[model samples]
Target: MSESVVSGLTDLLQRMRQAQREQPHPDASLRRIRLDALAALLRENRPAICEAIDADFGGRPAEETDLLELFPSLQALAHARRHLRRWMKPKRHLAGLWFLPARTLLVPRPLGVVGIIVPWNYPLFLAVGPLVDALAAGNRALVKMSEYTPRFSALFGQLVERYFPQGEVRVVNGDAGVARAFSALPFDHLLFTGSTDVGRHVMRAAAANLTPVTLELGGKSPAIIGPGARFESAVERIVYGKCVNAGQTCIAPDYVLLPRGREADFIATAQRVVARMYPQLATGGQYASIIDDAKHARLIRLRDEAVAGGAQAHALAASSPADAGRVLPPTVLTDTPEDAAVMDEEIFGPLLPLVPYDTLDEALAYVAARPHPLALYLFDNDSAVQRRVEQSQAAGGMCINDTLYHVAQHHLPFGGVGASGLGAYHGEAGFRTFSKMLPVFRQARLNGVGLLNPPYGARFRRMLDLLLRR
Candidate 1:
């Protein structure tokens, strides 16, 4: 940034802080206003957002954006707006026997300003979805759009600036240096969505401010096909999640965990599914391109590593080298050794590795051995096995018969445990994420406990003892 721009930003931030400090009770009305503005901003910029995303991807499919990104955000916005008032209501609670005359309530208080670091994979939804929570919880938001999606970031910044004031909603755009500066600020709360490695850096930076953080980080999420699983449905759902945004989603199924005797059949079914999904190979209009060349190169290297380790590789029948514009074939590998490079790292690409497991226990053991995934897919109908898997293993969330669909339900809490990430946000969870639940006990004039106030005589002691004896 130029000297003038930096000075302007510094001045603006100071002014916003002053305004927030001067507000009476953080102005819940201001929160509603910001949300209303956000709805307007999105409604107005829908076309422009689609265009910028297309420009970034050298022409992303508008229909796909509508189906996958735009429509979902609109739906989320409507749902949040409709329920914001009730979510903000003070929740009444049961008073304990000891505090008999006091009424308990959970008072929702806003954390002053929040910082949201959005990723590029699904820039539209990722940026706005969390913003919904921040606004609903009555907190001011400062957004950092990813540098990878430059066009969309620039446009989004413009929309935010035009509709909202810095004190209400602000957008910051830049490369890593600017991101570092933004993250270093002592915001009241910080929410980040990205890789596990970068999530560490964000947490470190937020620690400087002593700021609480909610990380929606991703890892090697796994999809396991059990013996009685429906191969076609399982493969289709897994492929759909992975292929969305060309396998750049944080929660996309990283690889497949195949049962021993069913590996070949699963592979064959997956190939057929891919063919049905994307008929024209690399240049298929239905398929999306990888976000950038660097990611494409990394996936290529991972594929080469698997090949070098003597795993049987099958390239998707339709991937043409000529039209490989950041395009990777929906490839699969078999006979993958436990020590293979693909097994060592998170496979954030279209390549699927099939690691055969001898039994259900072995499959559970394999997943348990790795860092807990953000989402786990268990494709079995047996209630006993499902209960066992759910009890024995830990994950951010699980989909019993499918993959990644659990996140779509606004009622569910979405986040990871252990290494996957910390904290969850979706519906009420999102509201709570940005809210401080202050416990309040409203007292009545007639307090029965006044009888024992500092007059520890024989009668008081005897009464206290009688009350304490359960």
Candidate 2:
């Protein structure tokens, strides 16, 4: 890392540590003020924020940014504001009869300075979502923006400085080397949102300091279309999920599992849905472009490799004149081999693979064989099937007859399972993740512990026996 970047990071961490030490437990009023300021930062710079993301992605749709990034950020802030007081209140627990005059309380306190690493996709929401929780939990935070999205990262850094004090919340803009150094900082807590491979490195870096971490990693999240499902509805929802943000979302349906003999029908329906959603893929501004040339090339290579392995690649829209834009037309792959590159890795783009299954058991087994995904989707009305999937399958979150909406519900705790991720953060779960729940036990003046205290004797044995029996 550059000397200037190292020096700046050191200074920022020291400032945050000092600020947190001075106010270990911020009152609800102060937390609300911080949240209000954050909301203002996002609200006042809405246009610039959208434009910067658009510039970064080459052509990111403004509406998509609003829907995917700005809306959730505002909602998270609003939810935290609404329940901050209750979340901050300590929970009282009654003591056992043996300790009649004692009381136990669980108090939530800040975890000092926190480090947040944001990914390029959904840059704004990922950054602010965790910020809401960190601020609600009364911790100073330093966010490291992804190097891939330079325009948005730089703009967000500027906005953070404009709205927040350097001590309370700061933004870091740098390359991968700086990110490595930032992750190694001895913060009280660290939260990283990105791919699983990188998550391992972040965990290793955090381990040197023994810092607690919340990893929001991604995997090959699957969408299963059950035999009893509404076929057209399932395809439509999956299309919406896959096409939005050009299927760059971490939790977007990476692939699909459909009943045997329905592959052709599903593909046709998905194509129709895509066409209707974006009448002109080449020129439509509604459809977001790939983040950059490298990502676009990667997606193309995955598709080409799958085709070379004997898979059938079908473009959603008819071919158009060649262009230099980063947009890759939504494509669906059928007959993809198990060993195909697209099937092996998390396809973080607009390419979707359709896997046919003979039975629900086979579908469930297929998912089981892979790492637990961040999100799983099922389109079945049967309560029995839902129950079976709920009990059998392991995933961070699920949606019945829907997709992508589960993460938006503030009441739900969002995170991955196993390789998908380690910890969850959303709503109150998020607040608790950032805060340390310190348990306090208070002993009253009048207690019956004297009988059990002191050297071993007949009285102590008798008292122990009575308590044990009780």
Candidate 3:
């Protein structure tokens, strides 16, 4: 880590901390103003933000960026703004008869300064979504953008500085070393979104300061095609979810579980769906390219390794020449070994693996054996099967007969489980995550509790007995 970068981040943290101390609680009007500023920032720079993301990714589709990043971000902001006052209000609690004239209230207070570390994938949504909660909860924040997406990072940083004061919300752009130093800073709370391996490092860094962390990490999220599922509908939705961002999404279905002897049928349906979705791979405007050559190559290698391990590889779209672009046509692998790299790691790309199972129990068992994923998809109309699978399996979130839509619902809490992630943030849950719920109890001068505070006496004994009986 560069000394200058560390010093700069430390200075920024000090400023925010000082500001938070000055105003520990921001009024609802001020919070709404900050949220409105964020909305305006997005509204005014919509085109520029899309272009910056497209430039960062060699050929990220503008429409995909809008649908996945911009839309969700604005939705989160709007939700927060609409409910800011209610969320900030102290919740009242009932006081017992014995404690008459006493009041109990739960107050939500800001956590001073918060640090948010965003990942490259869905950069805008991840950054903006968390910022909405942090700001709504009345905390000053510092965001660290991924170095991989240099164009978007720099553009976003400039926009934040232009729209908001540095003491309120600041954006920091740096490489891994800078990220390491940034994570080490003592903040009231830290939220990191990325892979599990790196989440460990972030947690370790935050540990020095004893900063509470909310890690939105990724894992091999699986999609199961129930035996009674509508095959065509399930395949279509899965294809759309997988290909939207070229399967780079953290909650994207990394693999599929199909009934025994149905692997071929599922693959054929996937191919047809992909073909219809992207008529042209080389120049199709709808299909997004991999973020860069390294990621593209990693996906290819995963497919190749699965093939070399005796798995059948099927390309959904026509193979474009390597020189054409960084687009790696969606490929499906079948009969992959359990120990294959693609199966072991969270395939954060377009490569999908199919695992056939003899029974639904087998499918559920397979999922249970691995680390809990961030999301799980089940395609079936049968309430019994849905209930069975939902109850038996453990994941951060679940969508029945759908994919990737759960995270978009502002009412739902989104995060991970075990290796997938820790702590959730969305809607009111997000506000709570960023805020501290302080319980306050006020006693009136005429309260009866004084009777029990003195030495052990007959009146105290009688009062205690009456309370215990109640």
Best by lDDT: 2
* Runs of candidate 1 exceeding 4 Å displacement: 1-12, 24-30
lDDT of 1 by residue, 7-87 (tens): 655565676667668772555566667778888988887888888987787646777787777776776777777788788
Global CA lDDT of candidate 1, please?
0.81
Query: Per-residue lDDT tens digits of candidate 3, residues 1-470?
Result: 76888898999899999999999999998999899999999999999999999988888888988999999999999999888889889999768787878989999999999999999988899999999999999999999999989999999999999999769999998889999999999999999999999999999999999999999998999999998999999999888888888899999999999888988888899889987889987687678888888888888888889899989998899887757688878888988988899999999888899999899889899999999999999999999999998889999999999999999999899999999999999999999999999999988777677788989899889988999998
Give per-model TM-scores. 0.94, 0.98, 0.98
lDDT of 2 by residue, 119-179 (tens): 9999999999999999999999999999999999999999989898768999998899999
Ranking of all predicted structures according to TM-score, beginning with the best and ending with the worst: 2, 3, 1
Taking every candidate in turn, the Cα RMSD to the unseen true structure, in Å, is 2.2, 1.0, 1.2
- Whole-model lDDT per candidate: 0.81, 0.92, 0.92
Task: Provide the global lDDT of candidate 3 against the true structure.
Answer: 0.92
Give the least accurate 10-residue stretch of model 1, judged by summed lDDT.
1-10
Better of 1 and 3 by TM-score: 3
Q: Indicate the residue-level lDDT of 185 in model 3.
A: 98
Best by TM-score: 2
Q: Candidate 2 vs candidate 3: which has greater TM-score?
A: 2
